[model samples]
Target: MRNFDQWLSEMRPSINEYNFYVNFEKVYANVDSMKVELNILNSLVGSKDIEQDFREILKRYPETLRCIPTLLAVRQHEIYAQDEEGAFLYDFSRMNYSVEQYIAFMKKTGLLSLIGEHIINNLVDYCLGIETGLDSNARKNRGGHQMERLVEVYLKKAGLEYYKEMYLTQIEQTWGVDLSAISAEGTSTKRWDFVVKTDQRIYLIETNFYSSGGSKLNETSRSYKMIAEEAKSIPDTEFVWITDGGGWKSARRNLHETFDVLEHLYNIADLERGIFNSIFV
Candidate 1:
């Protein structure tokens, strides 16, 4: 059995790749889709009578209104605003309101001054920067994917035949393995992150990386503990949990509970030591 303290010592702070921070391709695509409208709105920059000019622009290209929400770092088409007067839900998707109402919204939101006072030189460049900032919110999702990708690299190096995101039913059907012991006799809908098929056994794998600690870490540990217990009853099946990260440091008690019973629990350090070759066979 692997010592829990020794395994915990190998947890990584993060498994982020260079592309994990910001997906520039998605940012570029978003900006490209709105490029024409943003360029049209550029005419409002440093206008003499900005309100009249904005109204004229709206008449010519009403579609430019769709790009207005992004200026405020908002992704949705509908934005709700209220004053002492009343509340109104402004629709950026189409001209659902009068020109005067949208003008009021622009003035109240300070978008009119932002454009007319030359606060930003170009709308296209400003939107690109905005999209980049917005893309950072996707880092959590990218972090999980990065861990899976890293595990896949080692799996390939070990020459294992594996399928990703396979459901329990599919695994049983494809490999002729009986997983009902873990699947609650076909009632449980469990999906393995990677399912490796070897001559002796089917490995049901789960992979994740967490940089920060929260209740989620504890919950994950407990859930995996239950899974580890349940998996033992299934013949010709092995459960492998490949996890790492400093977040586990804070939740080590719960993690140790799972680690005590999960024989195939491993981290990045174990993978470096060729755990796959020794165990997968």
Candidate 2:
């Protein structure tokens, strides 16, 4: 047996190797995809007469209305709002009401002022800023990918063939095993991060790396422990959990509980020491 305390101490604080946090390539592609409608709205950038200019733009290109929601960093086509005046649900996908209602929405939401007062010099650059703000929300997801990507490289180096983002149905169907215990319902779904096959057994893998302390670490540790416990009843399967991060320092009790039950729990330090060759062999 190895020392869990020592293992936790050796875990990496982060796996970020790249300086560019937000994926600008994805952002630029998004902007390019909606260029036509964006240029239509660009007509309002420096309008001395915004009201009529906006009305004329809408008259010529009604589809531009769909892009309005995203201008405010909103992803949905319908936005619900209420004021002392009354309640309203503005649908940008199409004209849900008279031009007057949308104009009211624009005025109420400050879109009109933002355009009329020349707050934005160019629509593309302004939306790039909004898209950048929106992409920041993807940082957590990107952090998850960083760990998975790093693990994949090591797995490849170890010469193990694997499946990525595998679900219960596919694994059970392919291997002739059962995993209804983990599914919320028989017909519903659960996915493992990766699955590796060795000559002796199949390894169901879960991987994550947290950079900071959080309430989620405790819950995650507990949940994966339950998964490991349930997975034992399924034959020819081994549950391997690979998790790291200084965040686990704050959630030590639950992590310790998991560490006690799980023989295959490992951190990046283990990977660096070429633990995969031992486990898969």
Candidate 3:
């Protein structure tokens, strides 16, 4: 099998396309939901007592009630079930909350806000073709430069490796760890991302660039759990997951839970400290 670097080089385009498609889906869904919610909120604006109640709730329980799933559900039910809207209005009236606080929370955490900002900036130039656009057939190619620039900026600031050797060299020099890129058959996998050997243990490190979604986390967690269990059978081997890229921002909440279950989960920042400190310190 090809090593991870080669596989990544060959697969980066497809992975990026997947990311954009997923993001677009999320944006469209959120926008549709927002429109419905806005209409419901508009109707409630006429009720002075209920409006005052909502404002109080927003002030008090911003984190719990203002979460994305709850907000989405509230809006969905308000728009679809008119009967429920009366109950919702009654509930809000008792609580003392306001619509403004809800909107503020949406603006704070929603990825749509970021997407909207990007669209506003590039709408006339890229979307409308009012300005020059680069020639590219791939979806990733269209916005790939921006993504690469972001990645490069993050790598420079965070000491993440775009190329594999930088990571391996850091490990070797800082902690006396030697790294090799290996394959599944126990052969030297040149395409492998990282294989590090310390005085007492050998570790197989896989650097995933994919976004961390709930489903993705479940699958990765299962794989890592198996690897961890399997590594125990070997007596002296270890596994480490080194994930990076902006994709992590979206599913960080779910990923955090997944990491908690795994014995060895490290991001680029953790990797920079040298594997010795990462695992031990």
Ranking by lDDT: 1, 2, 3
- Cα lDDT tens digits, model 3, 1-281, are 22333322322222343344334444444445334333333322333454354355456543323223333333222222123223322133222335664444444444234323333332112221211121122345435344334334444554433333334345445555434322233443233245555556756556565533346755765666555555555545566665555445454554555465557765444444554344521
Better of 2 and 3 by TM-score: 2
Candidate 3: where are CA atoms >4 Å away? Answer: 1-191, 211-214, 245-257, 272-281
List per-prediction Cα lDDT, in the order shown: 0.91, 0.85, 0.43
- Against the hidden true structure, what lDDT does model 3 obtain? 0.43
Candidate 1, pairs of clashing residues? none
Quote the lDDT for 165 in model 3: 30
Ranked by TM-score, top first? 1, 2, 3
**Superposition error at 157 for model 2 (Å):** 1.8
Number of the predicted model whose TM-score against the real structure is largest: 1
Better of 1 and 2 by lDDT: 1
**Distance from true location, Cα of 72 in model 2, Å:** 1.5
Runs of candidate 2 with Cα error greater than 4 angstroms are 17-20, 178-190, 214-216, 222-236
